[model samples]
Every structure is written in C-alpha cells, then in structure tokens.
Target: MGNIALINRRNFLKGSAIIGSVVVAGGFWRAAENGVFSTGKGPAYTAWETSPNGLDGLVNAALLAANAHNAQPWLFKLGNSSIELKADTGRNLGPVDPYLREMYISLGCALENLIIAAKENGYSPIITYFPDQQDINYIAKIDLTTMKPLHMELYDAIPKRHMNRGPYDTTRDITQEIIVSLMNLNIDNSEVKLFMFDSQQDKLKIGQAMIEATQTLISDKEQIGVDPKWTRQSWQDIEKYKDGITTDAQGLPTLTRMIAKILPPLSPEQNNQFWLNTLKNKHVATAAAFGFVTVRDPQDYLQVVKAGQLWQRLHLWATTKGLGMQIMNQLSERRDREVSLNLTPVFGEKLREILGTSEWHSIIQFRMGYPTIEALPSPRRPVKDVLVSI
Candidate 1:
C-alpha cells in the first residue's frame, strides 16, 4: 500500500507539473493525501486500480503526453479494470484544428501510454473509438484483460520519445535496415512511403520545399490567426499559461515564437520567394527529413485514429534510436485546401498524373537529428481539472 502511495504521489507531481522536473534526484514533489484522491489524481471512477503501478501511474503517464500547444485537453472515466479517453472539447483549438487533427494526435499519445503501461502490468488494452459520438468528449474505450505482459522492445522507447525539430546529422546516413524497421510498423491500413534524400542536393530541394510551405502557411491569414494563440512564448510562459504548445513544444527554441509573432505575413511575391529561398538553402543545411503518407479514401474517424497509432509507435521508435523528430504536418494541414494550392507540381508530377486528383500526399513530415540542447518539460493541467467523475 505504501508503495502504491509513493508511486501515486510521484505521478501526481510529474503529471500536474512537468515530466522534465523528475530528472533531478531530490527535488520538491507533489503529494497525494488520503492515500487515494489527491491534487493530480484524476476523476472518481468505479474501476478497481489493479495495475502494478496503480491507476495513478497510468493516468499520470497519460497526462504526460505531448500535445499541440501543450493543450492537455482530455478526461478519463475509470471503469471496472478499464479507462475511457474523452476529449475536453472546451479546450479544443477549434479554428486551427477545426477537424481536431491535433486532438487526434494528443489522444494517440495518451492511448500509447495506456497501451504501454497495460503491457507493463501484464495486460493488453482493447481499444474502441467513438463508440459514442453523441458525447464529443468520448474518444475511446480501453478494456484491460488479464494477460502476462511480454517485454516489448517498443515499450522501452516510450519514455525517450520526443519531437526533434533541430537539424540532424546529415553526415551519418540512415541505413536501409532502419528504414525497413520503420516501414514494418505501419499497422494502419494506410500506405506509408519512406523517402530518404541522402544526397546534399536532394536534401536541399526538400528543405527549400519545407521552408516554403512553412513560410507560406505562416503568412496565410487563417494560419497566423489560428496558430499563434497555441504557440507558447517561453518557459516562464509555459509555467504561467499552464497549457498548450509552449516554446518547449517539440523541444524547439522558445525564441522561435517571438520571431514567428513578429514576422510579416507573406504577400504573393514573398510567398513565392520564400519557397525559392527554402529550396536554395535547404540544399546546404545538414539534417535528414522523412515524409509520412497515408491513403485514406475518405478521411474518417477510424482512419485518423489508426494513423495516430502508427505515428505514436514510429515516434517512440525514433527516440529509442537516439533520433529526434518534429511533425512537419503542413501537407496534412492543407488537406481541404488542395484545390486552392493546385499541389500537382508541388507534391510530384507522378502523384498528380497517377491519382487523377490532387490527393493529399503526406499526412505528416518530420526532421530528424540529435539535439544540441535538451527541452524543458511543458506543463499539463491538474488531473482533477482533466478527469470527470460520474
């Protein structure tokens, strides 16, 4: 019981605060009173906490999942030997994530933690999505069955998984073996292609394309207005605001926020020039990038969640390999605006010619590399605030 209490308290401290703080050997930590309910303990549910780490461990770990702007928008309904993930729509980034794309990723992160912890506790989680959409918050139902947890190599990757936005070591070329490993993990029905631009010239072209996309989107009125609110300015601001993608999002520099906010939105000429410069400079930059593609005929709820699962595991795998990644999901972001961009030439002539329609090519993009500096932990809302009791 005392062991359970200690784990619970540690989780509360880590969840409500930041996971990065847990690094220090001896530090001020949050505590759980009454041995059951405490400040960071999630909502009261009827479930019996039977995991080796207890419900608190599972819930707190879920809370640690990184989300857009660090917006910890979720709630858990503890059930008999199970946990339910529901969206806290009130905290939704409605305009930018109108379709809750980022929300899906956030939920994926939580589900990833749950799956890992369940396995650690000798159980496999059964996941069902939107079993009830009448409740917008209800995301999924997880049933934990009694089964001996086999040691999964992927589980070892969980705690280390992080979004790496910085430049990677282009000199250290990625082997075909690693690429195959990544390819094999695509459990979803979606088709995934891994493109490696190992050459300096190819890297340059892709870099320029990415910069162009980022610059163009940044200036896009809809994007600027919608994305800025979610971008946290500094570590102090993260502690102050207490949620959303802080500067620590992807562990990128916080100053990027300041620069982003001050930059002028691109005009037509500027947008084109931005792409041109991106292409020119990308050729010289030192890093590796990858494109994650999905083939969802009509993007629906199930497809998105499955993409999340594949993405979550891939992300963890990258971390285990000592690689860092940051989602370059701009292509996915413009799924609805394909016609406006006339992306045929941009994506590739083959995609344009083969599909006969401007199908979304990349669902996600990521730059990989080891970081020069470590990221400070972003904040999450208190468990009491996130979880709702019946």
Candidate 2:
C-alpha cells in the first residue's frame, strides 16, 4: 500500500479544487447571509413548538430525520390542512454533492418521518411528488385532511433514530430474526432494493473497499472543504451552528467530547489517520453487518428521494430494535455511474454482482449493530428556522 502521507498530499489538490468552487460560487457567503451556519433548537425546542396533531407538529417530527451532513436542507410551508416541502437552496455543500442528490434524499427522509408522525397523530398524509414541473424545489405536498390517525409502531422511534459512528459490540449478535424483520421493511416494490450483508466474507469485502473509498475521500480537498463546513469543531461552534456534525454526535466518549470542547478547532485536512483506520478498526470489519440501498436509476431524482425515505424507515426500525447504524457510502457518491470505487474496478463490480443488480448503482451503505453505550444526539435546526414565510 502507498504511504498515508503521500496519499493525503496527492488528494489534497483535488479536494481543494472542490472547495475553491464552493468559495468561487459564494457558497460560504450565501450560507452565512442566510444564517445557514446557525444551529441548536432554540427555546422550547422545535419538537415541542407545536402539538403532535397538526401540520406544524408533523413538520417538526420530520425535522428530526437524518440528513446528509445534518444540513437539514429542507423547508416547510404550513397549509390549511397540508404541508409543502421545498429544498433549501441556500444550504449548499459545494462540489461534494454537485447534483444535490443527497439534498433530495434528505427531503425524502424528512418526508418519511413526517408521514410516520402524522399517522400516529391521527392524520392521513397523501403525498404528491414533484407536484409542479416548473418548480423543481417543490418536492411534495402532504394533504392531511382526509383520514384518521392509525398509530404506526415506527412512530415511537422517530425522534430516537440516530446514526452511531463509534465502534460497535461485535459480541452482541444481531440475530437472524431481527435481520429478517429489517429485510421485511422493504415492503414496497419500488425501484430501490435493500440488501444486508451478514456473512463474514461479505463484511470483509465491504470493509476493505470502504477503507479504499475513505482514502479517495480524504485525498480530495473539495470533499475536505465540504466536510468542515458541516462539522462543528468546538463547543461554541456546536451551540451556534446547531446543525453540523459535532464530537458528541460522533460517538466519541464523553470525556473525549469534554476535551474536544476546550481544545482548539481541529481541521478537516488533518483527517488522514483517523479516516483511514476507522473502517478496519470500527466499521464494516467489526459491525454486525453491512447494509446497502441500490437504485435502478441513479440519476432519477424521485427514485433517489424514495431511497432516502426507505433509509429513514429502516434506520428508525433499527432504533426501535435497540440497534445503531452508521453510514459509509463514499463509494456510491462517486462521479462515475458505475460501481468503480477508488480501489479497483473489480471491487465495485464485485459489490454490484453480490447485490445481484449489475446495472443498478449502490446509492447508500451503512454498518449496523448494537452500540456498547448510548449515543449522543445530533443537534437540529428549530422548526421556526425552516418555516418559509407564506
């Protein structure tokens, strides 16, 4: 293998180019002007800002769904008896998410959580996707005036679903029964397909490829810039820009998080060793299993959003089962349409073949198992923050 130092140096330029584009495009200025950097659920907290029975409350529950970078790239317009979900164009991630695939998936996640909450609170949500051809930002409208609340079991896990990034307890086996339950969650015959890798060999294959993907990611300066933008390095920054990733949310030990609070800000470029070693030491290699969500059409916007919805549902389901999941999908977000990862062409091909969908692209992947301890909750933007003036 090549030297880690050499690899880090090599990819720094590529990553820098992406960051430069974001700066040149004024992503930072726009984010700042729009107060996109702001974080924390202020005052009574967005979850309790409204009752669990109305559009506002439903939107609040949706706000808790996981999103790429925790950017929460969505806005809501409360209607007479429905809610409008729109993309927050102001919260850009530069070149890392060039086509905004992650953004739409994020909207879908919010949409899923909203539906679950709505159903539990006695309102039926009728979804209309891409309601307006002219306005691409108009994702969907949930009309809640027609039906009665049918409490779904997944509702309780809405707020509790989290992405745990720390090491998992390998001894705590995720039994076949639980795996079957998770697999059954693919009740919808959609274009998206979900697969779980439980075998030691499959896990090892993915674990190794993930290590390669991280090397590719760490070398790219643009991706580096993209990360620090959504990562709060200090306690002050965490409370201020309440939406980005923080140490506490990262599955770091309580003491480590405490130390992090007082230490000087850690730069994203200084991420070579940690990123490179994590896969082998903590993720796919040691987790209970690796899971993937693939789509027939990687370029299809609606399909991608639906993938996010499916992810949130499964993630919440995992939460209710007392399991934790960690997403490690750098391979899927590659610019190439094929499964070609940074490692070898054959590696991606193997993943596609194993999933039994040679033509489909893996949209997202994650590691799941029981956590050794409880995880810290990631902060979110208050409901009022995402409300668009209508």
Candidate 3:
C-alpha cells in the first residue's frame, strides 16, 4: 500500500482559514445570473413561480439531489409547459471529471428526482435528450404540457433521503428481499447485479481491502489533485461553494478530524497503521458495503447517468425504509475497476472472465443502515449562480 491520504480534519474544527469560508444559506437570494427570464419569445411561456402545483415545486425538489463538490451544476428554462436541464459548465470539476461523466450522472440523479416529484403533483413530464446542437451542455428538455397525476410511492421517502458517512450497524442484515426491490428499478431489461458483504467479519475484510486500495489511489499525484477538488476544506467552504463535500456535514466526526491533521496523508507504513487503527478503534466501516454492476452496456455517459438515477432512487427508497447510505468509490476507480466489481463472492472467477474489455467501472457504491445521527445539511448556492437563460 502507498501512503494513506489523511484528510486535514482539524482545519474544520479550528474554524475559518484564509482561502476557505463558510456561508450557510438560511434565506433565498437572487436568481442565477443570466437567469432564464422568458419573454414573449419563440416558445410560449407560463410561469410556474406562483402555482403550488407547477415548476416551482419541481425546481425545489430537483435542487435537492446530491451533486459533485456541492457544485449544483444545472440550469432550468421554464418554457410553455416544460423545463430545460442544462449542464452548468462553470461548475465542472475539470481536473478530475474532465470528460464530465460524473456531472452528467449527477444531472441524471436530479432529473430522476424532478420526474418523481412532477408525477406526484399530477403532471406528466416528456423528456427529450440532447435537445440542441449549439448547446452540447444541454442534457435534456422536458415537455410538461402533457403531465398527469400518477401515484408514486417514492414520494414518502423524498424528505428522508440523505448522504450518510457514519459507521453502519453491521449487526443488522439487509435481506435479499430489500435487494430485490432495489433491482426492480432495472426492470428495463438492463442486466443489473447486486453484490453485498454484510457480516461484521466480511465488512472488516472488505473495508481493509478498500482502505488499501484508496491509499494506493490517492498517493498518485494526479488522482490526489482530482480528489481534493471534490473535497471542500471546511463546512463554511462547503456552504459557499454550494457543492463540495463538507467534513462536518457529509464526512468524518470531530475525533477523526483531529487525527486527520496529525496523519496528513502518511507513508505506506503509516497508511497501514491508520487503517489498522480505523479498523481497531473507529466505526468507519459500520455496515456491509454494497455495489451495483451492469452487464449489457458498460461504457456510455447515458448509461452512467441512468445508473446514477437508479442509485438516487434506491438511496431515497432506503431512506424511506429508515436506512442511511454512504458512497464508497475508491475501488470503483477506472484504474481498479477490475478488483472492485470483479471479485464478487457469488460470481467468483466467472464474473472476472465474463467482464470482457467492456470494463466494469463502478458507477456507485454505498453502506446502508439506520442512522441516529442528524447531519447538518450542506448549503447550496443561490440558483441564479448557475441558471443560464436561453
């Protein structure tokens, strides 16, 4: 194992630094600049601003979906009866996500949430992908004119869906029944497989492997810069960026933060020791880690986005069932995709052999269980910062 990249947790506890600042949003602000202000223009427009049943509600819900670095990268154009979903190019994590794959997946997650909310409110959304040539960033355009009321059980869990980073309760088991319900989302004939390691012994073993893998990946300078870009320095920084992950809200506990400063991404021996300590003392790997695998199509941005959408849906569904989840993508890195998904207990060597050069890159991974802790909500920038009026 290479040196373990320790997070500077003390920095968050010590308060603000020169470069980072915390700015939590307790009130509304101006709309995003270049805001989509439709006029008596090409497409007829009906403002959903006032109606309790229109665009306003959908926008609010869409805004809630998880994002990269909290960089909520999207803009909406309220048309006659539809909303346009455009990628906020300014928010791109160029260094890490240069291809913008993660951004699209994040957008897809948000889009799925919007659809769920819209349906519950009695409106049908018609989606058109890649609507315009000039705007390569524009992912989709949803025509809402034909929307109708539909019963969606997912609504009840919407409010509970949260990003959990705490230790999971390994004593409890996530049965095959729950796993089957999650697989139902893949009902479109997409080959989706669920691989889970639930026992405490299994979790510790997997966690050890994951920790080793993450340490190795982070030691690479190129990947380090990429990962840090997604990591917000402080909670205050988190609030201001309206995107990056925050320590106080999304990750480590106070005690862990103190150790972070001391470790500061140590040597290989230190990394091993850190992992040993984490396994011995901390509850970082609380639950059995879970992963999703797609068999038919392995490398399309659209498929990645679809997987993310299903991920968020399952995440919310788990939340509604009183469970929490934490994403673990270290093993899923493009470089180590083989080790992560290939070593599933059930498929064994056959799975590895079958993956064929299609490269089974992990789209998402999480640890789920009931959470008793209340995490501070990460802040979001005013919508105006990202919205571009077309």
Candidate 4:
C-alpha cells in the first residue's frame, strides 16, 4: 500500500509540474504575440518623450507630423542659423503617389511643425520656399533668429497629435463653434481653403465617394502591389525600419490586433480587403464630420505644400480640442491615378460635385471626431537619419 501511495504522489507531482510549465509557456507566447515587448518603445518613439533643444529638437517635432503611409520623406540640412528642408524623393510612394503631390504635402507638414517648434524655442523663422528653384527636391529654407520664446497652444499639441484610424464616437457631435474655429485655420491663406461637411447628407455623399475611390484604387494591380510595401508586419521589421504602418497603428481593437499578430502575415489581397472593410465599417460609418483642403491649383507644388501646412496646423489644433482626425485621401489618390493614365475623371467629377465648387481643387480630405480608442503613434526615423550635411 505504501509503495502504491508513493507512485501515485510522484505521478500527481509530475502532472502538476507539467501544467505549470504549460501555463508559463503560454504567458510568454501571448506576450510575444501581442508585441507587449516592443509596440511603441525604442528609438523610433523616443522623440515624442524627449525635448532636445535647438535644431535637433525642431527636427524631432517635424518628424511627428502626419504623412502619407507614415513615410517620413523629408531630410534636413542644418546650417549655422538656418534649417533647409528637402524632399527625399527616394521614399516616394511609387504608383500610389505617381506625381509626388502627396510627397510635397508631407514635406509641408514637416515644415509646419518645424516652424512651430522654432517659435516655441525662441526663434523667428523666415521661410524661403524652393531656395534653389533649380533643385526641385530643395523644399524650404528656414532661417532662424533669436526671439523671446513664443509658445503657442498648437505647439504644445505637436507631440499629442496622431492620426486616428480607429472608429470614432458617433454619439458625440462636434459643435459649430469648433467647426468655425477649424475653418478659421486657413482664413489667412488665400491659396488654400478649408471646407467642412457636417450635415448627414454631406457626410453620406463624401463617405460614398471615399469608399468607391478606395475600391477603385485597391483594384489597380500596380497600386496594390506597391502599397503593401509600406506595411510593417513583424515587430522586428517595425523596429528595424521604423517608418511604415504597423498593426498597432491600424486602430484595431486590442484583441483583434493581438490575434492578427499571432496569425501569419496577411497576403496583399487580404490586406487590401481588410482596409476596405475597415473603412466602410469603422471609419466612414463612425465619422462625425468630413473636411477638405482645397487649393487653387492641384498641380502647383507650392499650393500643395501650403495645403499640407494647413493640414498639420489644423490637426494640431484638433488635438488641442481633444478631437481625432485621419486623412481619407483615397479620392485624391484616384484622381491622380486617372490623370496619370489619362482615364475619365470619374473621381475628380465626384469631388467637384461634392464640394459644389469647380473654383477650388481638392488637395486633401480627412474625417474628424472623438475616437473610441486612443490612436498610437506611427514610427518615425530619427533626426540623425534625416539630417543631410550640406
């Protein structure tokens, strides 16, 4: 009896030990699968938390500006008292942005942030656009002079501003006062105009146009092929590249993001379909309002850049007002593609009809509202990576 009891006790102890080991292994697996070890940590995100003084700090702030596909496509040439902004054309979004319209707008965003940071750092920035007209890539030159530090509310919102791609709170409506304030953001700029669409009818019109444009864009073989190149699937890639869109920034529910991480990487078709579905179900359906930044000429790079600066300032202001915003530039993307291919301007016509204005060309469109979930910051290349020694 004693020997039997001893054998049973040993078996029970062995089973308990095995169960404990399994539990431990499962915990680690879950942690790794969810990217708990990486997500927003690392050199890519350090700029948001730190405030280095001078040119480096300005560059860091510029790095946080909203960009197409999270592609940080601007490089800096720091001078004794000037900072030159240049477009890194190599990072251009292939067929996705054939004309580099979005690219210049992205540089404009960076330029806006740099100017805001300069003011906050006690400098008056004198900006010269296309300092070297001979070099198209030479975007802007900002000559800074000492001044009493002028801190603006928009400057304080720089680090807090993020592109919210998740579903917004439909229950909360943005007020007319807030919308008017947003409209006033571009009142001083005659080249760029801001249009707001808040009525349910207008929202439906814009949402349908955006959905159709997205469908058309994803159907293009070249676009689909090139677009996925900007998506970072693994944590390793996210950290190593520190530039493209990641799962965490997709605005997926926490559990959904975790599940996606555990699964094998999605195929290009799957990714495209997922984007469309999310746009239809989460983004468009839940948006509280739609807005457009229209310019006198879409082909004019300077106007596009100014449009971008307005967008950056608008987004920062929105952030200060505790609002969430995401660019839904699919319609513009489709229009560009049509122009490139000399196809019928189906999307362009739609945009004009929605805006009720042929006088202004739409350069960018975005949705704004209160987000259901907090938006995470996309990874940014550090100042060191972007600085060019001139």
Candidate 5:
C-alpha cells in the first residue's frame, strides 16, 4: 500500500476508447475451429458424455474445473454411496507452489463441479473434508445418494465456463447488478473474502502489481523453467495428454493460434518478452475489472479447498451471467519454501489497507470482462485416467 502511484486517467480513457472501437466495429470475433470449444456443442466432455451417471461421470464433471496450469492434480476413488477425491501428489508444482496451496485450491474447484453435476444428474452430494486425517492426500469424500434431478443453468455452464485471457471490450462496464451478484456468491463460505475493483485507477494498480509478479516468475530460470512442465506445446502432446495449458487457452486470435502450431516448442527463457507482453495485454491492459480473494488462513488445507468450491460456484454463476473470468494467481505463488511468499507481500499489505481486515491472506486474484470473442476451452483428460479402483 506504500509508495504506489496513481495512473494517468486520460491515458487510461484513451486506451479504452481504442479497445472499445475495436470491439464495437467487429463484435465478438470467432476463430477458425480446431475442435476445442466449437460453436456447435462447445468443448467436448469425453469423460462425462459416455456414462453421465455413476462415479466415473462424477469425476469427469469435476475434471472440467479450472486448475493450476491446467494440471488437474486430482484422482477419484469409487465409493458405494460416495466419491473420494485425493490429491495426486504426482502433480505437485514443487517450489513454484512450495506449500501445495494451489494444488488444494485446484481440488476445491473440481469438488464444486462434482457437487453441481451430482445434483443436476439426480444424485444428492454431501461433502466431508479430510475424511481420513491420516491421509493428507484425501481432500474430500462426496457422499452421493439418490435424488430427483433438478435442472439448473450451472450444470450447463460447467462446460461453458473457462478463463478468457484474451483482449476484452473496454468501453463496456460491468453492471453494478453483476458486481453485487458476484460479491454475494460466497456468503455461505465465511472463510472467503473478495475485494472487487471496477474503477480504472484501481484496475491499473492490480495490473501493475500483477505485471511485477509475472516478471518475477519469468525472471527466475528455475520458476519459469518449471512452468514448461505443465505447458503443452505441440498439438500432438496436447492431444495425447489431453491436459496441461495449451496455446489456444491463452485466448489468442485465430492467426496466432495457428502460428503457434507451426513453430517448435520454445523454452521459457526465450519467451520472456512474449510472456511479459502477452500477460500485460491479458491480465492488465485489456481487462474491465479486477478482484482478489483472501481466506482466513493461507496455510489451512481444508479451508483452501472450500475456498475453491466457493470460487467454482461464483465462476459458474458468472458464466450464467455471460461474464468471463480469469484467475491471475502469480501474486500468490511462492518465492521459495517460505510461507507468505515475498512476491505477494506487497499485495497482502495493499489488500489489508483496502479490505480493512488483518485476518485474511490473499489466495487468488482474477479479472472479469465482456469478451469480444469466445475462446476455445482447454482440454481435459478422460475420466478413466483419474478414476481409482478401490
């Protein structure tokens, strides 16, 4: 909160004017289809489509959630009247996420999806966190009992919801009604606190801070180097693994997505400028509004997971509202093995001053706006891949 300078309002307005013209002139641009999130049915639910009922389908629905670098670090153990979700420790991000905070939060996103899918498809889900204290890997067990299926828009939105990191319409403002709706979503999850910023000046501050965090991550060879592990380059690799971050998920234009396909995999060391420029556009410059999330304790495992469940609900609700959200979490990534990663301390202090609460630590940050196009959804691993036989 200290020594942060205000941005020039005139420049902000001018840039917004240009983006507004582009969006107004062209409307939501559609890219040539490569079979990701097509216009017809949207992203394929290979996992949920086959069964649509039973444990495998449930896990398949959960798999559709947003995750860390799209790692999808979770597994499902079939249960008679329940489905157990455990951390696939194999998917850990090491020092990049030293405490496995993102991993657990990712699991929470998945769990939220599973619960909604359960109810929509006629199963009543009762979730119990850390069902086995002896096993830290045991995130939660969702007890599924029979119920009369209740049709809901969120069930349809589960597949439709995705991170839109591309350029967005600047002239358009998020209605006060929408902002209030998003803020009120996590009322039941008392541990989660959200701070929303719709003002241009506030957005600039978050953008500047996020840019710093992004620079920090890419500057360190070890951190940026580790990122490639979860980044899929070749179409062959993305198709084979059916997981990890892909070029299409960046919300790039059709030309760029196609150009990316032609090139060989570039190392993060070589792409520092590309990463910086891309994120500046995606995270800072083009976004309409930004917000951050904080929980009671950053280190509490179950709290982190429940926070994620809350996030999933808000995300799906946003989807129903026709708003797109992208999580800018580099501010929360660890600088080393130490808790309260130094990279995020500035944001924490700033949040403390802004939110007027000293009890919460920042967990996730996001930008939401009206997009000019519908980017293809990221791919998911088949249900068989994550289902564990017990």
Candidate 6:
C-alpha cells in the first residue's frame, strides 16, 4: 500500500511540472508572437528602407512624418506629377480632438514630408492649401515640376526622426546656438511663431500646466475612453493595424514591457493613471526645455496646419543635431476640448499666460533634450494603405 501511494505522488508531481513548463513556454511564445521583442521591424516600416523615387517615394517619406497619437490620419491621392494630401477624418480622436484640430495638423505633417521628399527627389513642389472649399478634407494639392535634386540635411533626417518619450539627459543642456538654429527653420513663416522656455522657472510653469491639463483630460470620461482606442496593447494588433501607439514606444523599461505582455492589459482608469505617472516622472521631470508653436488664431485650420509643418521641420532639424523630442500637447488638447464643449477656456487661458501673450494662440507644444535611451518608432501604415482613389 505505501509503495503504491509513493508512485502515485511521483506521477502527480511530474504531471504538475509538465503543465508549468508548458504554461511558461506558452507565455513566451505569445510574447514573441505579439512583438514584445520587435520594436520597429515589419512591413509597416519598409518605406523607410525602400527609398523609392518620385511620387511613390514622396508618399513613403510622408508615411514617416510625426503625427498626433501616431494616428497617421492622412491619405494620399497620387497624380502623374502631383500628390493630394487629404485628412482622414474617420481616424480622428473623438473627444480628444473634437474640433478636428489635430487631424488637420497631422495632415500638415504628412504634407511637409511629401514636400521635403519631392525636393530631395528632384522636384520643386508648389502647394495650394484647401484646394477644394467644398471638401475640407481635401487639405492640400502639391503640383510638382522637374528640378535638380536638392539634398537637404532635413530630408536625410526623415527616417531617423522618432518621438523620444523616454527621460532626457538633464545633465546636458541644449546650447543657445542649437536653439537659434531650430528657431531659424521658421524664420520665413510669418503665420506660425515658435517659442522656447528653457529656464528652470519656465519649465516648471509649463510642466505644471501640462500636469493640470492631463488631470483634466483623464477625468473626462469621454476623452479617456476615446484616447485608449488608439493604443495598441498587443503585438498582433500592432502589426495588424500598423497604426496607433504601442507599449514598446511608451518608454517603459524592457523588462516592464515584457512583463506587461504576459500580464493582463491595464484598465482604462489604470492606464490613465499610468500616463499621469509617466508624465510626472519620466517626461516632465527630465525635460531640458519646453517649446510651443503658436498662431494668431487657434481656430484657423490653415494656421494650425502651418504650425504642424513647422513642428515637423523643427523636429527633423533636431534629429540631425542628435536631440530627442517629444510632443507635450496635453495642454493644447485640453484647450481644444474646452472650446468643443463651449466651456470656459481654462487651459487656453493658462497657455496664453505661459506664452506671456494673448495675441498668439498655442497650437502645439513639445520638449527636447539629449535622451538617456533610444526612442522606438511607432507603427506606421504603409503608403499603399493610405492612398485613396480620386
């Protein structure tokens, strides 16, 4: 009887070990399949490497442009010697961008890239904004003419520009010379103005405003709900959609990201809190300088688009300088939300105060500095997916 009992116990223990091993193996398999390890390698990123020429190449470069939420909310209509950039309103963040402000801005980012690529690929591009008054979505039409290939430093930085969400190296300060160079990118643009806040006092003021705005945003249930829809938590979704924010790009440590892949996804509330924490700890804390782009009227879509173009150009220039940049647009977003709801423009007022002027309206805000870690690229929809008929 004792010998039979001992054999049964051994068999049970062996079976349990097998199940544990299978479970552990299964978790790892899922992680690998879901892209817990892969950061920027996929069909989505092929455009960066292919480097095709002419209109097709222009579209490829446009796909790499920086946009809000990684929404990539713009479509291209290619012509023999032209390209039409259209806003994909359907992809707009619902409450987060009620005015379609960010949507138009995103289209502007794509437009900037298209123009840069066109210039680099031996074409002089002429842009006509709002080519069709009836269809606001028809954002811009670029007519291209053959020209000598103009190799620009900004054009070369196209594929290299990724938003760095990680903590910056606070020890390294951006020099005045670099700041002046960045400012020069927008020197000819009269509509959109760039402002920088590098002093400790100024950074603290803007950082506090950002935190307050983030809190306001997360508390709004509708905004919080809509925001998460664009966040791709699984590797399957990341590859499948090829657009939207991913955990790997969130600046979390590698170990934390791996563990997050194995663990259940965070609830919306938890995710909101996590964002708030990250903003306070990783982002705002380490920002060496904060800057914002402003226009005379925030409601002017054209001005907003120009602001985005300025941002893209500035970012590309910054990339060449080996600086990391992240868009800190929560305050601007909250301001949009306020306008949409007809609420008092609390955030708007704060922004104006920070800029120390009521004349210019803040369209976009960002921070830049030397980064402690490399920023990962977010998934992008290939040019093929974004091309539209007619």
Which candidate ranks first by lDDT, i.e. highest?
Answer: 4
Ranking by TM-score: 4, 6, 5, 2, 3, 1
Put down candidate 1 lDDT per residue, 284-373, tens digits, no spaces. Answer: 264664545454432465555555666777777877777666566554455433444565444343333223445534445555555554
Give the clashing residue pairs of candidate 5, or none. Answer: 28-372
TM-score of each: 0.70, 0.83, 0.71, 0.92, 0.84, 0.92
* lDDT per residue (tens digit) for residues 1-390 in model 5: 000111111123344444445446662241222332331222333553444557777777899887888788999988788899999999887767778888888999999999888998889888899988899999988888899997888888887788777678888888888888888887655777777888988888778877877776666566666666776665456667777776667676654444344334454554566667767765578788887777898778978887788788888998888787888777666323224344435545555654567887777778888887685677688777888885
lDDT of 4: 0.82
Prediction 1 TM-score vs. true: 0.70
Compared with the true structure, all predictions reach lDDT values of 0.53, 0.70, 0.55, 0.82, 0.71, 0.80
Per-residue CA lDDT of model 2 for 129-191, tens digit only, reads 989999889999988865676877788887677778778888887788988888788756468
Q: Please identify model 2 stretches exceeding 4 Å from their true place.
A: 1-53, 335-354
Question: Deviation in angstroms for 129 in model 3?
Answer: 2.3
Q: Model 5, which residues run further than 4 Å from truth? A: 1-45, 48-51, 334-356
Alpha carbon lDDT at 121, candidate 3: 84
Those runs of model 6 whose alpha carbons end farther than 4 Å from true positions after fitting are: 1-26
The clash count for each model shown is 13, 10, 19, 0, 1, 1
